[model samples]
Target: MATQNLIPLLIILVSAILACVEAQTSDQTSWAKRNETEKEVITTLQFYFHDVVSGPNPTAIRIAQAASTNASSYLFGALWMIDDPLTVGPGPSSKLIGRARGLYGSVGQTDWGLIMALSYVFTDGIYDGSSFSLLGFNPVMKSGREMAVVGGTGLFRLARGYAIANTYQANANGDAIVGYNVTIVTYV
Candidate 1:
């Protein structure tokens, strides 16, 4: 009888230990050190581009609103919780537009306005520490280009880093010609 009770206690203790270990490991995967920085980056890009997204009725007013809201939430989560983000480089507006345009072009002939609008926000969010894959936590760019990386977003799983822009582009219409080029930098 004592042995049976002791066995159960052992199992509980082992499970508790495993849980603690998992918790600590997750912390190691965090990018909390750059949380504030990521938020600033995301906010600057999101504010401007989200407005652009609103202007174009790619879907409908309600749809656009939902997309905007979702992007905002994703951005918040990316900066607040996500560690690594895919990014390009910050550069001249002309160059950024060029890249953004190129990406849309590659997307196989979609609506130009919608493409550009999405491009602006897409690149912006990426450079702002948005993860391609959201561990147990969801990434902000999940709905956008972040998922576009590597056979779409659902495949890539682990992201323990941040991204920075190498270039940027703004269009004459105050839209993006290319947008922002950024790169992923691992979180340490």
Candidate 2:
């Protein structure tokens, strides 16, 4: 009877030891695989987009005339100049690295709300293919509006990220200056 009891105990002990060994081996294999994978790079890039919006073009007027009053409709585009806050000016600055094209429209009263799509082209910096594009709505009277990064090329190929836009300045004539802070992640 004592022998029978010892046999069961011995079997249990051997099984436990084998399980522990297998677990350790799996852990080591998983760690090795992680080391072989490429590391992800995280970076924050700051830039400003100063837009000088005036009035709607003929196309803008046509759309508004079909939908609502002209005062509530606007279609505009601007050349974004990338610059630091302290040295914000027209044309291009030494810090100027890229330009963005934006198309915006207002559907509410006197351009109270706007929907926009933007295409950013970068000639300098670590961005791939010299550019990345994004499309989303411009939240009216709201700060820190977020937009999705659709696609990119070069270093930004298969890129995925988000951008925050804030209005830096607005004039009575409807011209405004906006700031953009974009954060991106990619594998190197």
Candidate 3:
């Protein structure tokens, strides 16, 4: 009777040990910390985003108006072409690099919340395009606003960065020509 009980106990002990060994091995294989000597790459990118809202038909407009006041929420889609000449206006050889699409929720007369997605396509790079998301509070009446670059694709697999956006121009209809200064720190 004693030997029979001991046999069951022995089996249980062996099984527990094997299970622990498997778990630890798998955990080690899944994640590894970076070495101290591996330095991160930082890049500064500048671009202009042309948002047209002055024509009889425009790309951006107020989708909803505020219930009590003149404030309105807008949904806009714009293509941010790469201005190779570093000029604010459209150029001849300007290539399409990305698109900025988002909803602008008006909180105040000049204050708005932005939920935007940026998709970038590298025409002459290792891989095509990678996308990322942005959440920010933009004061259209102010000089600039800083937004968070939540995440992105391709070479920007684990991308995280910040963007400084300034209003370069606005027409009578309140359409915007914006400038972006982005500092990206990412690991591929």
TM-scores, each model vs. reference: 0.22, 0.59, 0.66
Each model's lDDT comes to: 0.28, 0.61, 0.59
TM-score-better candidate, 1 vs 2:
2
lDDT of 3 by residue, 61-169 (tens): 5555435444233322222222111223444245555555554554443344444444433333333465555566666666668888776666666768888888877
Model 2 lDDT tens row, 1-188: 99999999999999999999999999999998876796776667677665543554211122223323432344222212222221123323536666675555554454455665666766664553456667666676789988877766666665678889888777786556667788777666
Clashing pairs in 2: 128-155
Error of 1 at 1 (Å): 21
Q: How many backbone clashes does candidate 3 have?
A: 0
The true-versus-predicted C-alpha distance at residue 65 of model 2, in Å, is: 6.4
What is candidate 1's lDDT per residue for 13-120, written digit by digit as tens? 999999999999778657465563442211222111111222443211222223233345222211111111122333223222111211111111211112212222
* C-alpha RMSD in Å of predicted model 1 compared with the true structure: 14.6
TM-score of 1: 0.22
The candidate scoring highest on lDDT is 2
Off by over 4 Å in 3: 2-7, 10-14, 33-39, 69-96, 109-128
